[model samples]
Target: MTSAPPTTEPWAAPHARGPVQAAVSLPGSKSLTNRALVLAALAEGPSVVRRALRSRDTLLMAGALTALGARVETATDDWTVEPAPLVGGGSVDCGLAGTVTRFVPPVAGLADGPVAFDGDPGMRTRPVGEVLTALRALGVRIDGDRLPFTVHGTGSLRGGRVVLDASGSSQFVSALLLAGARFEEGLDLLHDGKALPSQPHIDMTVAMLRGHGVEVDDGEPARWRVAPGPILAVDQSIEPDLSNAAAFLALAATTGGRVTVRDWPAQTTQAGDAIRDLLGRMGCSVLRDELGLTVTGSDRIKGIDVDLHEVGELTPVVAALCALADGPSYLRGIAHIRGHETDRIAALATELRGLGADVTELADGLELRPATLHGGLFRSYADHRMAHAAAVLGSAVEGVRVDDVAATSKTFPDFPAVWSALLDAR
Candidate 1:
């Protein structure tokens, strides 16, 4: 992915002058919101999604579903989705949302017309061929394997047993499962490749489907069977995004302060909840109470060695934490992240190295050693999580500006305002 143009001014990330102590509340989970929208679009009745995240990614999901004939009312924080007949002859703009690019097409196959799909330039590089190939095998007509392709629909899909490698992304599995209930034979899908990445996301899909009265058998590893039936439209309450809390909690961890994230769920299917364990392992004190989950930073940020295969989304912020530690850290089992919004592993290595950290870029993850980090412009490569890492670094190492802090708009509507509010800055 390309960085913002040279002419674009960078956002000067707020530097923490002292221990950062604040109770922060984040927006709804983008993952859940998008998935909820998709389920609502295919459900048997109208659905309400409460406290939905109104961001670029989620808005794109709503727009894509609307384009394919789902009426999504998004004027307020709560979105109402009304399912209708899937019509053909529509064009969809996936933006940069992997969910929109990957998840929408499978449902579009149930339409009776042709749906053209395209997205942001970066999305063209993301791994989406698995969805298209799987759809083709399930008796759907797809014109191309990549972005700028078209799904020619004839009103129904012959869904049955299909095997493909889902090692690149878990969304491929979820895309089909989200729309599988309406299929004639349903979907019996199996992963025939390396270890599947983001298994929690697939689990989230299965759980939600079951909640919506869709029968899913996930007792077998990397195998999911969806039975043919109608999807019930259910009201969904989106939990406060635990993943976005990473940066705020990192503020406490990096500055030896205490930060509490309000409404942190006691139980969640979100893989981001893994951040609690990660921060605790890195020398932070974690506690849960009625107020929320609180993180108190340790005076010494200890380095860690761990695999992040299930929680790859935590890599960026976690990498920044590793850079500021007193010892070396190695993060592994997240090679699949290279296909995310950007080449996250490469972007993190480049930006961290530029900011004066000892970094080694491996095929799977990163190895970071303690170094005297200084101020520099950390390019985000148009990826939201990359900007998160930069903001976390700026809390300790001064002068760490982020190029294209707006990239966070993909998840949080106004991350700068949120981050600045932690410092009591407008």
Candidate 2:
């Protein structure tokens, strides 16, 4: 584990004012980067992935692929992968990336050796039973349904209908879909309840698979079918992360500054697009241009009552913004936040309470009142979103001390730097 430098200087609060202007570029999406890395590693020929996210999560995925016998090289915004038969018989440290821990194991099942998947303490607590059950149904030898688990692949997988209780993370379904081509009959997925959260992520998964020549048929809410086919090598560029864009948007809104993020695609399957509509409701002037998105700060942020089902990942950022709004904000449709890097709703509520905000955590979501924020020491719970949320709060309040600041490396390793740049631009 690399030691992150200490943030000895306390974050100073931004004075509430009017239109600040800046241009910012966020790291590529960890979701897209890891998925592309896995696909590239499984391809028949050498492939180049451009603008890959260089965060800890994506790096862990890349390391896992390399350990499984893929030769990967990186050169300034590009990654070249040379596929070789997976050596199989090795233990893979997935770090704290749930995506890598859950998604890579199924793919590793196609290798010739026993692959043991493990991660940080938090990753071990996250449930992988749904994926394990599905893999077991397909004849993979899985010792347990939890992390620190071992899988021995048989070089070929038998695919069939698998009933998955994805809970909220779409990576489980995505993992199976991405590796479906290597199966004899492909994969069929069945949902047990109201389907998983972040459904758009699943759509993104299907879209990426189709781009590589694999076909998946959507048969309704719970049923999905994938046809066996060979994945052709193709050069692909990942879209700029909409999730990371939220923090800057919030910064603009809170400080009454105008911030623009470059290279953001207008039409994206990501759930973070809900930020645009949500920001509009908060009285921010939002403009979508050919190059990217511009959000101008409002005189006063307004509270909103809405369900953030699709854009659940942005819940923490939005909720933090709500703490500075004019009235009480109620956010619903995020019961799954409890299962993320931390019990986000509870953690956010607790932290906000420490900052003197009238925040309450419900069974499904949270209700926060607009109040004067005071700075204090903030704990991140080692969750990346928590760290970012704390930073946003710090921007709005003085003397905010954030512990575990380095936790941002999980997604945006350069978060502190990017945040500093945004501040400097102001």
TM-score top scorer: 1
Name model 1 segments beyond 4 Å from true. 4-8
Candidate 2 backbone collisions, by pair? 20-257, 20-258
Q: Against the true structure, what is each candidate's TM-score?
A: 0.98, 0.95
Name the lDDT of candidate 1.
Answer: 0.92
Model 2: per-residue Cα lDDT over 192-310, one tens digit each: 76547888888888888888888889857757788887877878888888887898788888788888888878788777777888999998988999868988887899999998876
Task: Provide the overall lDDT of each model, using Cα atoms, as 2-decimal numbers.
Answer: 0.92, 0.81
lDDT of 1 by residue, 181-224 (tens): 99999999999999999999998999999999999998988789
User: Residue 99 of model 2: what lDDT?
Assistant: 84
Misplaced by over 4 Å in model 2 are 1-19
What TM-score would you give candidate 2 relative to the actual structure? 0.95
